[model samples]
Target: ASRRDAAPTGDFHLPGWLDVPSMAVSRSTSRLRGPGPANVSTSGWTSTMHSLRVGILLGCLAFLCGTAGAGTPLLLAGSTVLYQRVLTQPGAAARATPGTAGGRLITALSRLYVYEREDLAGQAWLRVGTDAAGRNLLGWVPARDTLAWNQQLTLALTNPAGRERLILFRDWDALRSVLDAASPPAAGRALVQGIAAGGTDRRAVALEPETYVNLYERFYLLPILEIKDYSTAAGNPVRAVKVASVTLPEARGRTAPGSALADQGSAAEQLQSFKAAIVFVVDSSLSMGPYIDETRVAITHFYERIRTAGLLDKVAFGLVAFRAESANEATNEQLEYVAQVFAAPTQVLNGEDFLTRIAGLREAPVATDYFDEDPYAGVLAALEQPDWKDRFDARHIVLITDAGALDGTVNAPAGTVPVNNRAVPAVDSSTGLNAAAVQREAQRAGVALAVMHLQTPAARQAGNLARATAQYKDLARNAMTQQEAYFPIADGTRDRLRAALDTYAGDVIAQIERSTRGAATPFGPAARAPAEAPADAADDADQRARIQAIVASLGHAMQLAYLGERRQTAAPEVFEAWISDTDLADPGLRTVEVRVLMTRDQLSDLRDLVAQVIDTAQTDLDGANSTAAFYDRLASIAATFERDPEATGRRRAPELAQRDLLLDYLAGLPYKSDVLDLKKSDWTSWGLQRQADFVDRLRKKVLLYSRYYADTFGWVDIAQTDNPRNREAVYPIPLKDLP
Candidate 1:
């Protein structure tokens, strides 16, 4: 293995396809292949099987337990302690008295169930620990209470013992094994690679469907093992518990981690197995102000784009800024910032937190302007950071700078910046390594580097400009030169800088996707949410629920229409617009989905139409427009949609045709159904529900006109030729000015 022989220098070839045999088999050794073992339940809603997923999540594929008593059911709730229950003795009253000294809530989830096992009632309840009184309690609330986890992952009752309320939870730690050469690829990414060969859907969509829910038409495979209890009526025990050969969930969705019930893999298991981290090394020296400033916009804009697309969780970002004490002057500690201080990589949650951290950060304003900077050290430090070292797959560093490094071997000109006389650490032969050494470290770390040459005019005016160019070019070719990682922005305008960064970001995503192809992370990743305030949690739940409902209703036919261009391809975008408007809580991104997919002219026309529709609907409100008025408006539009598309001919035939179907749904709305019509009552509340519904529906109709052009990573306006428009792919929604 240690022999260093001459390797082939030419590019490698793949014969049209690289086939990887599927690792899962229906054998008794590692897998569970079967119809469920049954005859032990007592309920009306009998259990059934959903084909989602399950397995070894920590060290390897978590195997299905051979025993029937697999796990304990988790407390499904909005807040764990919100509801309280009492562990009444066998002879106690039917209802325990409130505020009783012996009535402490059942708080402890650990060792929760023990008594009756063979026959047990299957129902969801909150299991809390003992209060100061030392008594255990249990509680139940309505199903809407558990909506947060419910929307993303499927939940079910456990087997015989779990039915007896003696199920297991938090088993991931006990089961975690160290990953070696033999572990199977993670289910998230592995499953994605198997579908459409991993190119049709995004890596996030393919891997963790919980976070990247909308990108793919077909959701993640929600593997349901078996249903415990199934009942049609209220107050019935669960109809049935879904069981599987392996510990899978239902067909609707997959779990992020271990909740109460049996083992639903951990978030780290569901997501990280196929994750990537990106580090940006900028020359934050005296002259780097404008570069870093503009790059901030690019980073923030890029983050918002992917976040809306539901793919932000797939990558993490780190920062590194390098500048040695101006030329030979060593007093300025500002310029002596180390590598790790440049910025360690972090997972991209919802916002550009890392970018924000660097926003107010200015370059070290030095006494004398330096034309050269030490990039090699910064690169080496980034590679060594825990973020880079810990990633199982896809590590990348994006180097952005206007200047170059000093080469000791070259007969360098006088007064060049980063003026190290062979004394700088690593660059000096006597005690330190040089740029070549840094380059080797990057390669050794398996990090692909994306270099952007931010050509500044001041740097061009330097006497050693020629030498700087030569050195910059060499540094640019540091690691993975063949991957198109270098982008030299010659014009150097703010627009050019942004474009370069966009192109740079795109390259990083593409390379990661390519490098991780046919491979799976030993474990996958699940997103982590910071602890939120009570009000904030409630608000977020409402907003997310609204979006999810629309996504859920975006039937295969609707998604197909939006994607295939065979019909109204913007139907789903239209649906989301309705969600943003009617949500009880503030939905952060309003019209991003619809706006980015529309052409510039289409966007303008849609805005005008939406404005006009709002104005027209405003006059009919006693309080607000009734559902009847909403239906009438829709009927009118459907009748003469082509005659007055947008009430103007700004739309093309294809777009107008798509708009018609949207009008049809609204026109056909049931005028007086209790659920559909809140006009007769509930006018005392905010904005009046019925009128709000009407307005939101009209907003959807306007957005549906935007003809969504399909692409590899979902849909976009195919006409956007420039990188700015393409990367600004998802813009924030405009606030409506309601009277």
Candidate 2:
């Protein structure tokens, strides 16, 4: 007889939390047991009563399953279920029986629950369905045809428009064989070519080259089912992950591949009229006159070049000037303004107007209290004050500064000066935005902030060059491009600065011209160094190389975004097979970026958790008589914080304790979190200053979370008609953005 879909054999139900619609696979594997007490006698009246109850419940479940639609869950017998979750292999077929005489094809990478297991000879078969709830059933299939996925980890392919096509291998040995070849790149190329040519040897490859997908274009799940970590013969580490592509319900009805917006035009034709804007955010301090003049000359030369190329109207330029800020109103009056926008991005299309606006720009008359200037003010102005979105598709802000930014930290070593040295009290930027916060806003605005740091001798002597370099690099970092648009001048000469600016501007123009002509400019592969070379030096050669690479990447990213938005270019709609997370030829280049699917409630909880930690630490540290006592208090507080929510008053549970979803997910993930797994010993090991720095970093992260919550456009609504804060609506937050 065919097995019936029914509920568990007794009056049993999952906990309230587990009553959620989604079935999350448990990370741990434990032995299954039947319902009722283990020691109950089978022949007793109590046992007979239990058996009768089980039978009645099973009968009711059978009636319900028969009456329900296809999407309803089939609650299987809990005792017989082997695994909580499984994913179908590519081209996997399910049959009515254990043998594959006749079968129906199932969706590859579909999440399923194992209902029953059968073993015959040496092979095993599993009865699987859509979820533990028994929503959709697919009959018995060979064990090898499915993969057990405990963790819900997924990988989304990075944009492949400007890079080589990503390859998927049948197995690890096939991938390793290519890596061990005489010339790995050449061998990989040959393999891809052979696969394209078509023959029996094509079986070595997992999927066709054109099927790789990005999460942004199509919101799908490519779950990482299994992973193998090993070192190559050359001692380089490599990670080989087994991935199964799952197209979510939302991806249905999208325009098929190769036919996106065919009626409008090709992606390139649509991009021919794409607009770009570049703004020069110059520091107007006393020492920046020469640099300011150089900036003007560079823009003048650039405008003439673009005009000659018949692209003057397509590209626009603007300028913003920033000076020092002070707490005293009189001192602020002397400084004139914290930051002033001299020209809107779209205001200056002609060379004459742009030159006229820039020609009168001058340095501040009086020197401020500290060497570090309020560059954040200028960046915010450049980002906020302009109609960048309405006028331009590709927006950029080139910050030309000799000094570091005024950091908000109380005693930060790099961008901060002593409180006593100031003639007037130093004030934060007018917008009250720090570097990281400014970068987030820039990201929200879809504008890239590039920094041209002039490493002058005075800056180096003031011990600000190194600090400023680090700060500027972070400020200019782009998450999409995964590169920093930071160009540092070793000599800090006007000629060098002008040349760098020219090269940077010229590269962008060239990219636009090439992209407009239907040609894609591929960024050069990263340059590898010998084992003895310094790891990450800010050398002039390296900086120039980075500038070129970042410019190219940014240009490519901008073009891709435009095309995706215009053409409605969705990701490929197909179940995928195994694909490598990293590039097969270049293991160092990751083809996939992992992101955490977070919700509004989770972010709010995170903020509250950090705030609570900060408050407890501050209060405990101040009242404790000794460091040991402080640690003791912190340990006790940590215990209280993670304590069971029910143990605490139901109305007043700790915010962190209430964050079950995020906490459980993070615990399962392999990455270490300082906040989640913080220990008393960890706190005790830190010196007083380091401890304070830790608190300060957490405080900043809290502030950033507020900005993220307010960014209404960044979050997506998976359920379009549902409330904005509904659980279905989520933001795929970059892992790096996590506190």
Q: Count the clashes in each prediction.
A: 70, 6
TM-score of 1: 0.32
Q: Candidate 1, residues 194-250: lDDT per residue as tens digits?
A: 442424322111111112122122111121222222222222222221211111012
Best by lDDT: 2
Candidate 2 per-residue lDDT, tens place, 505-560, comes to 88888867765677643322323322121234345465556567677667666665
TM-score of each: 0.32, 0.68
Off by over 4 Å in 2: 1-154, 161-163, 168-218, 248-271, 356-361, 385-387, 410-446, 516-546, 565-567, 574-576, 620-668, 674-683, 720-727
The deviation in Å at residue 289 for candidate 1 is 0.8
Candidate 1 Cα deviation (angstroms), residue 565: 39
Model 1 residue 737 lDDT score: 12
Off by over 4 Å in 1: 1-273, 326-330, 334-342, 347-352, 367-370, 409-431, 463-465, 478-484, 510-739
